[model samples]
Target: MSTVLELSDVTVTRSGTTILDQVSWKVDSSERWVILGPNGAGKTTMLQVAAALMHPSLGTADVLGQRIGSVDLFELRPRIGFASTAMARRVPASESVIDVVLTAAYSVTGRWNEQYEELDVRRASRVLAEWKLSHLEQRRFGELSDGEQKRVQIARAVMTDPELLLLDEPAASLDLGAREELLQLLGGYASSPYAPGIIMVTHHVEEIPPGFTHALLLDQGKVAAAGPIGEVITSEVLSGTFGLPLTVDETDGRFTARAADR
Candidate 1:
């Protein structure tokens, strides 16, 4: 399978502190990956690199066949969709849900002109519908609940038909029911042949949707384990990665993790 993302000796430092240390990893076009790590593990940094939002300080990073640093990020960015709480706040609160999604096609966070093509609107509507936000198309972006807003952000990410999609903590602020609904939607996308190579970052195993094939575990900015989900997401690895005794279970392609009671 072709490599969709590649990182060779990648390191990221900020304010003289190492955020990601010599992380070498690859995501092939055929697999969907989950990045699991506790807070401050540099999972978001890794996603930023994959999304072309940041460059490695030490080594080479490539996405969708283009090396970071050498390519025009403006052109490459549209080909890689990124959705996160951080990104959601960047969107204008006044924009309509449909326009918020449509702006992605032009790589703009806020709508400036109301001249979107008919086909673009059609595509945006379809994406929103798939994400279960069709009824909120005309609602103000800021008026939606956290769960609803998350779905809209995800729909916006796929608006440009990206080659790689990065979703950071998609289930973070949602309640159990909303999280499950979002997970099912993500699972459906994960199994789609036309879906982009996906990398989702989360701190909890329960947040991993079905059909995700690989896992990358990070601890204190270092990779603790990386491989097939069934291999790397074991109880032992989970315990080590979080620095606590934990049990991980999987059934019917879904995963769950819990702390081992003392």
Candidate 2:
């Protein structure tokens, strides 16, 4: 299978503090990966590198078959979709849901004076409808609930038909019902043949969707485990990654993790 993301001995440093250390991993086109790590474990930093937003200070990073420094990021970015809480804050609140999603075609967070083609509008509508956001097409982005906003962001991310989709803590700050609903949607997307090679960062194992095939466990800027989900997401790896005794469970293709009894 063709690789969508490839990192070899990747290292990221800020102010002489290593955020990611010699991490190496790959996501093939046919697999969906879930990144599991506690806070400050550099999960977001890894996604930023995969999204091509941050270049590694050392080693090679390839995204969508394009090497980071060698490719024009401006041109490469459009082919990679990213959804994160940080990105949500950057998008204008007053923008309409449909407009917010459509602007992604031009790689902008907000609408501009440029005319949008009918085809693009249809495509945006289709994606929103798939995510059950068609009813809120005319609503302002900020007026929606947290769940609604997340769906809109996801719609916006997929608007460009990217080859790789990076989701950073997408289920964060959501209520139980909303999170489950979103998880179901994500599971459906993961099983779809047309879906992009997905990599989601989350702290909770319960948030992992059913079709996620691989796992990457990060601990203090280092990889504790990386491989098939069944192997890497075991209790032992989870315990080591979190620096605490933990038990992992998988039932009906959904995962759950909890601290072991003392």
Candidate 3:
């Protein structure tokens, strides 16, 4: 399988603080990986590196077969699909849902004078349909619920058919029903043979979708464990990663975690 991302001894330091330290990870085109970590674990920092939005302070990052520092970012960034609450916050609230997805064709956040062909519009519409957001195409983006907005962000991210897909807490701040709904859609997309390599960062094991194949656990800016989901998501691994006794179980391809003593 082709390697989608490779980070070797990558570290991110800023303002005299280190966010990620000596993180060496590889993601192949056929794998769907989920990153699990607590607050300040550098999960988002790692995602930013994968997205080519930030450069590592040390080591090298190769995304889509191109070295980050040597490649032109504007050309490289469009090849990676990224969804996050930070990205959603950049969207112009007054923009229409279709516009939100369409702007992604040029990696922009709002509608401008940039022209799009009929093909682009059709693609955006198709993506919205796939995400079950076709009915809201003409709706104002700001008017959507948290779940709807999250889906819109994902739809926008995939609009360009990126080679690597990265999601940061795609299911955050939603009710149980909405979270499950989004997870189902995400599961279907991740399972597709045509889906690109995916890396999602989430705090809860419950947020991981059914189709994910790998797990990377982080603790205090270091890799705790990285391997097949089943092997790395065990109670033993999680309890240590989180600094507490924790239990992890899977049923029907879904995972649940809680304190082991509970």
lDDT of 3 by residue, 66-182 (tens): 999999999999999999999999999999999999999888999989999999999999999999999999999999999999999999999999999999999988999999999
- Sorted on lDDT, best first, the list reads 3, 2, 1
lDDT of 1 by residue, 94-189 (tens): 889999999998888898875888999999999999999999999999999999999999999999988899999999979999999999999999
Q: Measured by TM-score, how close is model 3 to the native structure?
A: 0.99
* Cα displacement (Å) at residue 12, model 2: 0.5
Backbone clashes in model 1, listed as residue pairs: none
Name the regions of candidate 2 deviating beyond 4 angstroms.
none
* C-alpha lDDT of residue 91 in model 3: 95
Judging by lDDT against the true structure, name the best candidate: 3
lDDT of candidate 2 over 147-262, digit per residue (tens): 99988899899998899999998999999999999999999999998898999999899999999999999988999898999998888889987889998999988988888998
Per-model TM-score on C-alpha atoms = 0.98, 0.98, 0.99
Cα-based lDDT for every prediction: 0.93, 0.93, 0.95
Lowest lDDT 10-mer window, candidate 2? Answer: 234-243
Lowest-sum lDDT 10-residue window in model 1: 107-116
Provide the lDDT at 65 for model 3: 97
Q: Is candidate 1 or candidate 2 better by TM-score?
A: 2
**Residue 136's lDDT in candidate 3:** 100
Superposition-based RMSD of candidate 2 using all C-alpha atoms, in angstroms? 0.8
Quality of model 2 by C-alpha lDDT: 0.93
